[model samples]
Target chain A: MRKTQPYAFIMPSLLLTLALGVYPILWALRYMFYDYPGYGSATYVGLDNFARLMRDAEYWNSVKNTFIYAGGKLVLTLPLSLILAVILNKAFRGRQLLRAIYFLPTIISASVMSIVFFIIFNAYNGMANQFLMKYHLISSPINWLGADYAMLTTILIAVWGGVGNYMLLFLAGLQGIPNDLYEAASLDGANAAQKLFKITIPMLGPVLQMIVMYAITVALKGYESIMVFTGGGPYGKTDVMYLYVFKQFFPISADTASMQRFGYGSAVGFASAIIVGVVTALYFYFSRKMDKIY
Target chain B: MTSAKILTLVPRTILWLFLLLTAFLMLFPVALTVLGSFKTNLEVTVGATILPKVWQFGNYSTAWKAANFSRFTWNSTFVSAATTVGTLLVTTMAAYAVDRANFFGKRFYVVLQASMLFISIGAVVLRPQFDMMIGLGLQKSLWGVIIILISAHASIFFMLIGFFRGIPRDLDEAALIDGCNFYSVFWRIVLPLLRPALAVCGLFVFRGAWNEYILPLVFTMTRPELQTLTVGLAGLRYSIGSASETQLMLAGACLSILPMLVVYIFANKSFMQVSAGAVKG
Candidate 1:
């Protein structure tokens, strides 16, 4: 009993994590190589699912879409959030209120918020178009949800949803930079842009690296909003990798032609996971190299 | 001196303008949602108006009924609460035991947790996870999602472990000397001391469970009645059975945000502090 006491304390979490967290991942690994339709017996189809994955156009398109989406989000969100964080970090009236308001979007459920966005961006009589048209920005409503602009629309919402969380993160990082650095920069007659580039950006290197890594993984994994917003619709133009794989398992979308293909999905999932893992590994490798260079 | 002062004032004015504009952009969608909730459908679709001609407070009740929000809210509350409690218990105890005791496979367990942190299989593993639930006979209810949510405690486990290390071993030893077992020491001494950590982490865990979309979305697919608020609210687009129940959806959106908003308002400091601390490690 004395020897087993520690095990007893850790057993519940150990068992649950093993069962739910670790097991499912191992389970996916095993299922990826089989011809399992989720109900019938899974036959050994060693590497066939992967072979098909290589040839799959839709899956490839999703990979492309994932890059575009993640890239768009990263490009927009990093700069925007950093700027917001910098501005909000200063002593000002209503700073807390402003920070909270910015952070508000981060806390809301993505799917629910995406539903609101769906309404706002609705091609006809939507708030966005209405607002734009009211100000005579355009004579007619742009089909924001149409295939031509759907990806851009989703990217905008993604940036909006994400900018705050990153801003808060930047704020945290900003707190670490000593005021003297900025004061010293001021004393040296550095302008705002110059200080931002030479002092702020360099000072935020490690934190920014982590944030960018985080942003990349999160952007890659994001599908909830898009799932709710477009259901990977308008000819699958907005279908990211996760949404595509999700369609394999849930097939909730009316447009998705395939039903639950567990084997192929597991394979696709394995591939997608590999892609994300590679991206993450490459980021770490490059960031470390940059560390050496700097 | 006057030119220098003017230069400083010019940038200051521009900064203020920029900050105010961003603040407006950030608040506009949320504020609009609130206003739209109280607006007539006709008013919402029509371009000119920002607020309802007459506030339709009844839209809340109408949406609440139409979206089955009460049931969904209850489900969300139950699942989130259960997940939070389970996560706290599991993480705290495990963290306490790991920090305090020398156990078999301890190194391996630590390595496993670390690997789990980095090796994210993501949504790909959902099918297998669901199948595992089916194997356990938990696939039919919200319990499966709750269990999955609880099991994804690697981050929390690590966080609690950090918090646990801050707690002195002398206290545990003293408790042990006072005729208390390890369990009682944890329950009576350390657990209470962990209130702050638990509260911050628990709020986040609750939020994650509440805002979670895909797991509940998939698990509750067969049972519409089991859907949580996020899933239910997302479904409002189609389920309202009209060309557009935009007002109703806006109402549901407001409702879904309320509980979290309240939590954020009260524990605003903790939320900010924890999130800031999270990145340091």
Candidate 2:
């Protein structure tokens, strides 16, 4: 009875987690081997979906785009966030005000921000192009979401919105460091750059490692921004792997060529999940190896 | 001035300038939105200006009716509230049990719950999710939306576990000695102490459920009546025929975001706490 009491307390969560969390992966894995349109009965086609995933140019393009998009987000966000964290860590007038204002975007809903960006980047009357043209930066209005710049636009929007939280995280990590370490380093005639490289970076190793895993995973699995902003448009030039799988299931547009490839989509989804898992694992493994002996 | 003073002053000026620029950039869009919300459609679409010539506050009423936000806001509130309450109740109970009691499979449950924080096999599971819900005849139900919102939320449990651990066990023992069973001790003693944690958890979960789009979208696809605010906004047609309705879309967007902004302003301190490693804000 005593042993069972704990189980009783956790029973609801356990059941819900299994039903929603674990079951979906298993069911989707099973679905991956079959060809089912949304309504029709699924037909088993073992390994065919996987084979087609390899051969699918569009799928591969999506994979490439996912990496580029995720990579771009990481490249733009993490370093800038780190810099903001460092700057915000210092004592200054209006520090709290600046911090709060910068944090404003992170609290706002992503859909709201996406809509806001959409208006700002509107083809006919975008503030970005208008400002650029006003400054004689361009001859005419450039389509920010055109194929040439869609992914870049998506990446910029992501960086704009996501930098705040990561900055906060870094700020937390920075605050956790004992002040004595910096003071001790300064006693040894260390300059600001040396103190940063030698003491601060070394002390922040574990946090940095954790943040890398988080940043990479977040960037890799990002779907919401793309879904709202571009919808993987301009002939799928801005398409990412996550959206590829989603479009497979939901069919966002009227185009129905790949609408019925439910099994193939499931295969893509599972495959991408696996790839992400492997990448996350590899990151952990290598980061752990070089995790700073100090 | 001395060169030393000049050097320090230059960097200080540059830093302040940089900070102010970023602040302006951050606030600029919001300023435009707030200003543009009161603009006519032609002004919003055709001209790019910071302020409207004729402030049309009616845009709010028009957009509110156009999107039928009153109904969708109700949907968002009901579903999000239920999910937040359920999540808090369930996770708090689980955390209380794990913190206070000895039990079989406890280790497995804790580890499994924490693992969800990182490894999410996302996007691949939507159809299976749909199939499962549809089979249970829950695809069109508001409860379906609520349940889906409540499910797969181990992160809250993870956060609450910390809160529970911070609680002294002596409190539980004292309550237990006062003619209280384990359940009473939890309900009467521990649950009260968990209020701050609950507020953080509730705020986090409420914000998430309120803003959630795709899951609710897919689950309630068949039942337009059950659509949440985010999905409702997505489905709403801002214009009827040839009229460019940027104002309405902007208005609706502002309306959709108003609740969150209001919540954030009130909970600003809690949000800051959450940001600084309290709940991974």
Candidate 3:
């Protein structure tokens, strides 16, 4: 009776998972092999979708864009967040206020943030370009949303919105460290540089790993900002894989020629899923290995 | 001693400087947006000014009307509240069962939870789920979106359960000895002890539902009246064409964020504690 009662308690969640989670994945898998419009008659086209994805130029472009975006975010945001975390970890007046201010963006809606950034980075009347020209930092306002700078601008916005949350994560990790370790290092006459190198970084390994994994996952799934700010515009310069998949399903252009190939889009979705899955798996493997060592 | 002190001071100073610069960069967009919200359209287009020459308080009222802010706010509140309460109830019961019960498929449950964590957003699976919902006659409904939110958040609920397991079993035993049944013991004893975890879990579920975009965007397509704050904001941003209208849109954006800002300010300390507890556990 005791055991059976527990099963009853868990049954609701299990049923929900089956209904909403497991069944959906299975349905997608089934649909992948079929020639189905989003809302039309379906026919099996076994392997045709997969075969076309192998040679799709747009799909490959999306793959390249995903890598660049993810790489850019990891390189720019991670180090900056780490540095900020270290500084905020120190004793200072008004540190909490600063921390709250820094973390403000994380709590806001991404779509809203994207809109705010779009206005600030607007080509003709943006504050960024106006400030630059006012100070003679530029001869004229650079077109930040143009093809030449769109992806980089998108990256900057992403990093700015992201750094605060990661900083807080790292701050929490830093707080968990024993103060006595720092005292002991000070007794040994270690300079701040030595203390950071010898003690702080090593102690923060687990937190760093967690942050990196999160950053990579978020970067790989980067879509909302692109969707709102650039709409993968200016010759598809900012088009990442997720946006490409979204476009394939809901093409903005009304021309039949420009209409998305849902069959091919599913293939793209599957491929992106595979890439993210592999990366996440590798992250877990490495983290687990490191855990054993530590 | 003097050389060592100098070297230590230099690195600390440099680190502080670097942090201050980064913090400025991070805070700039938010600060600028707030400034933009208060500016007239003409001032907004003219240049970057720290303070608006003409502060337009009416823009807030205009934005609220333009976006149909009341409808979106109500929809978001209802959906988010439902999700939070449903998730807490379902997750706590499920977690209790997984942790305390001697079940036959416990390992399977564990694997399911772990896989849910690692799987990406399951975007590929979205259409089929939509199809299934359509087949079941649930397309373009608020309830459909609520159900999706609950399902999507199950993994986090399981994580909270894992945290709950860290609490000792002796508490449960003592409660049982006081003549409480499993449900009573869970409600009276275990559930009360899980407040911190529940708060963190509730906040996550609330935030996720409140800020959710794509699912509601896709599922609630036919029903404009059913849109959440995120989709409403997206539409508002897209529709505003003129510079003045854009300034008005910024006001709308500020109005949308005002509730969350107020909540965060009031709950800042508890929010931090709950979030830290979730991660650390």
Q: What TM-score does each model's chain B reach against the true chain B?
A: 0.94, 0.92, 0.90
Spell out the clash pairs found in candidate 2: none
Off by over 4 Å in 3: A252-260, A281-293, B1-13, B242-244
Model 1's number of clashes is 0
Q: Write the per-residue lDDT of candidate 3 for residues A122-238, one digit (tens) a residue.
A: 998887887888789999889999989998999988888787778777888788778899999999988767887788777877766776787788789879777878887777788
* Distance from true location, Cα of B62 in model 1, Å: 1.5
> Please, what is the whole-model Cα lDDT of each candidate in the order they appear?
0.86, 0.80, 0.77
Best by lDDT: 1
lDDT per residue as tens, model 2, B1-281: 99999987998788789888878888787777778889988787666567899999998888677657777888989988999999988888888888899887889998888776666656667767777777898876788778877876787887887788888999888877888987888889999988997898788898888888888778777777897877776665332421367677677778767887888777866766665654232
Best by DockQ: 1
Per-candidate interface DockQ score: 0.70, 0.61, 0.55
lDDT of 2 at A180: 92
Rank order by TM-score, top first? 1, 2, 3
Better of 1 and 3 by DockQ: 1
Q: What are the per-residue Cα lDDT tens digits for candidate 3 across B135-233?
A: 877776788788777876555665677777778999889888888777887788888888887887787678778877777787766688998877787
On a 0 to 100 scale, what is the lDDT of residue A121 in model 1?
A: 86
lDDT of 1 at A120: 86
TM-score of each: 0.96, 0.95, 0.92
